[model samples]
Target: ITPASMTIVFLSITIGTIMTMSSSNWLMAWIGLELNMLAILPIISKPKTTRASEATTKYFLTQAIASAMMLLSSTINVWQTGNWNILELKNKFSTTIMALSLMMKMGAAPIHFWLPEVLQGTTLQTALLITTWQKIAPVTLMYMISNNIQPTILVSAGILSMIIGGLGGINQTQLRKMMAYSSINNLGWTITIMAFSPNMALMNICTYIIMTTPIFLMMTNMST
Candidate 1:
């Protein structure tokens, strides 16, 4: 993409997250999320290497499914309650679907199969972006609907993510791959805390991101 195009894509990504983060309705949030998804694929594919191609394809497929699930869940909620509010997801089935979709989107277990492979194939910068930046919208929406989702589901996924993150990386050779699992593990803590306290969940995410910064920077320096 040209510099101008890249600028527009990033702008779209920004607009998407802003919409989701600031909106009252699920429609606006869903739209924003789709825009972010569209913008990110191009950014991930810019290198045009075989590895980059594979990464973008995998990411697109995974996110497409997750996005579809979000749309479905939100629409179902609207149908059931005759409301479009993000903060008032009342349908039990819809809430479950939404939670599962977000877990998939965030690469939390047992739907986390794509994260490690995608990270292994993308550039260090892109992988880092996926690990941190791309998480905000889904996690924010998760926070919004946290009260509606089942705590048992969140707790189970959180525990599994932590377990997998720890066990899967025991023999990793690539630093990026290890960090991918670490991202999953850190996300587990956030999800676990989400069921009881959104504030603590956000805190966990913030602390994890801060800790990740220097590690990613060091990896970047090493790569260069």
Candidate 2:
């Protein structure tokens, strides 16, 4: 992508994430997610290699599925509750599906298989974006609805993510893939804490970003 086009995509990504984070309704959040997904595609495939193409396709499919699930759950919620309010999720089935979909979007485990592969195929900078900036919207949404989600499900998923993330990274040689697992691990901790304290979860994410950004930048500078 050209500099101008890159600038535009980056802006779109930012706007999309902000839209999702700030939206009070599920429809707007879904639209923001779609925008975010679309904007990131070009960045993922910019290298134009076979691996990059594969990663782009994988990412698009995974995100599309998650977004579709989110939309379906939200629609179900609207059907049952007669409102589109984010804080008004009352249908049990819809709530579970929405929670799972948000987890999928953020690459929390069991559903986390796509992440390492996608990161490994992209440039380090793109991988950095995948692990960091791409997380905010979904995490924010999850936080918004934390009260509606079952604590048991949240705790189980969180613990499973932590286990998988830790165990999965041990044998990885690729730096991007390793970071992917690490992202999973850190997010797992965040999710676990979010079950009891959301503010702490938010602070954890901020801390993760601050600590992670420089490492990725340094690796990028060294072309490692």
Candidate 3:
């Protein structure tokens, strides 16, 4: 990637996450999510290889679906509540749809079929960003909407993700796939904690980022 493009990508990533984290408005969070999504596609597709191209395509499609869901959920939310406030989510159907959309975006269980494939197809650095930084915006939104999300839904997704993450990793030989499962497992833990304590959810995410960074950095050049 050119220096200019790389700078924009990095800056967009920061802007995207901050937009979601700081915004009380759902549209602002969606904007941030879109910025983050658009920025990462170029970065991951920079490699001059077919796998990179395919990975980028798959990532784009998956995120597009998630983004569409997010937008639809927000639209319904506003229609019902006549408000765009993130915390004003009161409708059961809207809450469920929004929660599921964020879960899919974050690659949570039962809806995480895209994660391993994308992680395996992309370069280590891009995979790192997808597994770590890419989650910030969606997870932040999840926490903000935690109050409205059903406990049963959260617990179901969390347990299923943990099961899949754990079982899926046992038979994986590739490093990235294994790490992808590990990310899924950690996300499960985060979602579970999100049910009872938003602060704990954020703390778990912080700790996961801290621990995963050095490990992925070390694995950057270490092939599968």
Which candidate comes out best when scored by TM-score?
A: 2
The TM-scores of all predictions, comma-separated, are 0.97, 0.98, 0.97
| Per-residue lDDT of candidate 1, residues 1-224 (tens digit) | 89999889889888988988898898889898898989989888888799889989999999999999999998999888999999889999999999999999999988999999899888888787888878888899999999999899899989999999988888999888899899988888889999899889988887887788788988898989
lDDT of each: 0.89, 0.94, 0.91
Please state the error at residue 209 of candidate 2 in Å.
0.9
Off by over 4 Å in 3: 221-224
Q: Report clash pairs, candidate 2.
A: none
lDDT per residue for candidate 3 within 102-204, as digits (tens), equals 9999999888999999898888888889999999989989988998899889988999999999999999999999999999999999999899898999999
Q: State the lDDT at 125 in candidate 1.
A: 81
TM-score of 1: 0.97
Which residue segments of model 1 deviate by more than 4 Å? none
Better candidate number, 2 or 3, judged by TM-score: 2
